[model samples]
Target: MTERVVVDPITRIEGHLRIEAQMNGKQIDAAYSSGTMVRGIELIMQGRDPRDAWAYAQRICGVCTLVHGIASVRAVEDALDYEIPPNAQLIRNLMIAAQYVHDHVMHFYHLHALDWVDVVSALQADPKATAELAQSLSNWPKASAGYFADTQKRLKTFVEAGQLGIFAKAYWGHPAYKLPPEANLMAVSHYLEALEWQRDVVKLHAVFGGKNPHPMFLVGGTPNPIDLDSDSAVNASRLALVQTIIDKMRTFVDQVYVPDTLAVAGFYKDWFYRGEGLGNFLVFGDFPSAEAGTNLRDPGSWWIPPGAIVDRNLNEVQEVDMRADAEIQEFVAHSWYDYEDGNDKGLHPWKGETKFDYQGRGGPDTPYKQLNVDDGYSWLKSPRWKGKPMEVGPLARVLVLYAKGDEATRALVDDTLGKLGADKRALFSTLGRTAARTLETKLIADKMQSWMDSLMANIKAGNTRTFNETLWEPSSWPSEAKGVGFMEAPRGGLAHYIVIKDEKIDNYQAVVPSTWNAGPRDPQNQAGAYEAALADNHELHDPKQPVEILRTIHSFDPCIACAVHLTDEDGEEMLQVKVR
Candidate 1:
C-alpha cells in the first residue's frame, strides 16, 4: 500500500471532515472522504409529533439554520396535500431568496475567500494601487485610497500583535496562491466590509420569521401573520424594512460579491481545468410562483427549475422525481451504519435506517490514527440518483436553470463566461463551482425585488392572509402518510423525508447537500464528488501546506455539520480554534 496524505478536521468551514489521499509521487491517485461524526437526527425524530419536527430538525446545523425548518414544514404540507395562501408563497420565496444572497456572500467572503486571498500578502500591498484596483471593478463607494490605508492599518495591528486572529492557521505564503498583493488587499477590505453588511441583511429574516438562525416556521405557511394595518404583524413598516434590505442585498451582491469573484477568478483560470466531479448534477427546485396552491413539480413556474443533468450534458436535463424509490437512494456500504437488506443494497429515505455499526481499525476504547476506508469510512451515506452519484448545490442548480432555457439565467451565464473568455466546459471545474455561486446570487437578488413588489401589490389589493388553517391540526391528516420536502438550498438539493403514522413521525431522514457531495465511496466502489474531484489531476505543490486540496474542497463550501459534529466519549472539548 502506498503512503497516504491525511488532512483531518479540514478547517475554515462548518462541520468536521477528514480527507485521506493516496499519492502517486506528486499526483493524487485516489482519495477518501469521511464524515467523522454520527447523525442520529432521523432516529431522534421517531415518535415525535409531525408538526413539531421542524423545530428539532432545524437544530441540525446552526450554519444552515432555516433550510431544514423550511423543508420540514414543506414535508408535512406535502404529506397532507395542504396548500398555503398566495401571499404566504411569495413570502417564502422572498425569505429563501434572501437566504441565498446572504449565505453565498458569507461563504465567498468569510469562508472561501481566504483560500484564494493571502492575508499575509496584503501587508506588502500599496494602498493607492489597491484603491485604483477596487475602483476599476465596481462603483462601490468605499474605493477611496484612505479606506484602503485604514484597512491595511487594521491588518498590520493584527499581524504585529503576534496573532493573525481569524487569519490564523492559514497557508498564507504557499506557492499555490496566485493573487497579487494589491488584489489580496482589496479582497481583505471587502471581507471586513461583508462582516458588517451581513448583520443588516439578516434583519430580513427577523422581520418575517421573528428571528435569525433557525427562524420560526409553521406547517401550513409562514409564522408571520399578515396584517398591513397592524404594527405587531407584517405591517407596512416591516414590509418597507424588507424592501430596504433587498435593495442593500442587490447593491452588495452586484458590487462586492460578483466583482470580487471575477477579479479573483482571473488569477486562477487554470483551476477551470480541474476539480470536475462525477459530472452528474441534481437540484430539487425552489421559489414557487405567487399563486395559490402552485405546484412545486412544475418547472415552468419555478424561479430556479429543478432537474438532474448527467455527464455535463446541458442539452438533456432529466426530471428529478423525489418520490421514486430507485431515483434517490442512499447506500450504507461505505458508511458507519447497517441496513436491514445488508450494506450492498440501497434504501430510499422513506425506508432509511440509522443503525450504528462502527467498525474502525480500533474499537470505542481506542482511536485509530486512520479510518478503515476499505470497510466503512464515513457517517454520511453515498446518495445516488438512479445509481449514479450526482453533484448538488450552486453548480447543479445554475446549470439546471441555464439548461432549462431561463432567459435571465442564460444571459447571466453567457455574459459571465464571455467576460472570463471561458466556455461552458469550464463550468465543470473548481473555478466554475465558485463562479456559479456568484451568478446564482445575482439571479436570486434580482428576483427578490419582484417578490417584494408582488407582495406589496397584494397588500394594496387587500390580500393580507399568510396562513392556511385548513390542515393546521394533525386530526385533518390521514392515519398513515409519507412525503418528501425538498428545496434548492444554498449548499445544494436539501430534502427531508418524513413518514407519519397516527400524527407522529414514524420515520425521518434528511439527505442534505453536503452528504451528496462529501459522502464516502458507495457499494459499487464509486467515489463521491469530493473524492473524485480531489483525485482528478490534482498535484501537490507542498504536501504539508496542501492549499490545493483546500481549494477544491472549499469550493463546494462543504458543511459537514449538516450531517453531524465531533465529540469525545466524556464530552470534553476535543478541538478548539479561536475566531473573532
Candidate 2:
C-alpha cells in the first residue's frame, strides 16, 4: 500500500519549499521537491547595464550574500575578454575563500547542527561530563565544566520560560535523536558560540567589499582600492585585520566545527550508507591562480578544479564546458516557467527564458494534493548537465578532488574515514555530505593564508591596482557578446550567464546552486538531488513530525531555506507573516 505525505516550508528561513513523498508502507517510495515562490531575478536583469548586473543579481537570495555579485561581475568580464590586475584577482580570491569558510562554519553550527543536536536533551546532561566529552574531541578553550554549566543554565531558563521551542516540542524528544545527553549539551553550546564567531568572520567582507550580505563588486575588479596611507581604503591596518579574521576562522573550524561534525557522525554511522542521489557530481571551479596570463580554463591552475563525475566513476572525470549550449540546460517541464520552445527540451542559460506560466499551477480547483508527482508543481526549473541530474556542493567538490589524485584532499578524506572507523564508500551518503562541508571548510580556511600573503607581498612591491580601467568604456565596441561567470559557492556550483547587446543586458540567466540540487523532476523523469536522497533510506517514526525528513534535507543546506505560507485547501490564507 502507498501513502502520500506533504511537507511545506521545508526550510526555516528565506524560502518557500514543499516536499511530497510517496511512502510504501514504512519507507519512502518516491519524493517530489517543489519551490512555491517564484524567482523573477533573471527577468529583472533584462534591460540593465551588464556592469550593474551584480548589484541587482546579488539580491536573488537572502543568504550566500556575495556569490551572485561575484558571478555577475565575472560574467561581464568574460564577455569583454577583460583581464583584471593580479592584485584585483588576489582580492577576489581572498573574498571568495573567506565566504567559503564563513558560510560553511555558519551553516554547520547554526542551520545544520540543530538537525543532529537535540537542544532539550542537553538539559539532562551533566555539565562536567559534557566538558570532558568536548575536551576529548578538540582543544577549544570554551570547553570547561563551568562553561557548559552556564550554557545549561541559560538553556534551562529558556525552557522554564516555555520559550525554548516550547521546551523541545520542536522534535526534541524524537526517537531518532541518537546523541547522548553530554554530547547534545556540547553541541548546543557551540551552536551558541558560532553565533558570535560569525560576526567577526564577516568583517573581512566589509574591509574588501564594504559590507556583508550583498557585498559590493565591480565588472573588472572589486570595489576596494589599495591605499596604504588612506584610512577609508583597504589600507595596512585593514589588511592586518583580514589576517586576524582568517586566523579566527581557521581556529574555530579546526577546534569547534570540524570536531563537532566528526563527533556527530560517529553516532549516525548508518546515514553514511545511503542518500547518494543521481550518482553524479559537478563542480565549476573557482579561485584561479592570482597570476598574470593564467589560463582560467585549465583545471590544474584552479584551487577548486572544474570537472564532472558521472555515475560515481572516479577514474573518468568528464570535462565541463560552460560555453557549450548543449552541455548544460534547464528544463521547465515540471516547473512554473515557460519557454519560446516547448518545455520538453532544455534550454541553455545563454538562450534561457523565464516567463512565469501559472495558468494551471494554482487558483480555484487547484488540488493541493496533486503536487504529489505532477507537472508544473514547483517554481524551480530542473537543471541538467548533458541531460542528467547531478549533485553539487562540498561533497561533489571533495569527491572530484579525491578522484583527481589531489594528495591533500585524499589525506583529509582518509583521516576523516579513519576517525569515523568507516571505509571511503561511506563518502556518498547523508553523513558524508555533512562531513565534506566541514572538510572543505578546513581546506579553504588553510588556503586563505596563502592568498593573504600574496596580497600583502603585492602591496609591498607597489602593485596596489585593484581594478582595470582598460575595458571600462561601453563604446570599446564589441556591439554584441555572451559569457558565463561560474563559481564554487558554499552550497555548490553557481553560474550567471549574460548576453550583451549595445552594452546592455539582452538576457541574463542565473543557474544557482539551489536550483541544481532542489529543482523538480525533468521530462526524462530524473529525480532531483533532494527527491532521490529522501526516497532512498528514510522511515518515519511519526508522520506528524518528520524529523527523519529534516535530517536528510537539511544535510543539503538548502538556499531556498524559508518562511512558509500555510493556507486552507480553498486557497484561503491561514497564516500570514508580515514585516511591520
Candidate 2 lDDT over residue span 109-148, tens digit each: 7777777778988999999999999999999999999999
lDDT of each: 0.88, 0.84
Error of 1 at 567 (Å): 7.0
Q: Using Cα atoms with residue i matched to residue i, what is each candidate's TM-score against the true structure? A: 0.96, 0.95
lDDT value for model 1? 0.88
Q: Candidate 2 overall Cα lDDT vs. reference?
A: 0.84
Residue 327 miss distance in model 2 (angstroms): 0.6
- Model 2 residue pairs with clashes: 13-562, 15-561, 15-562
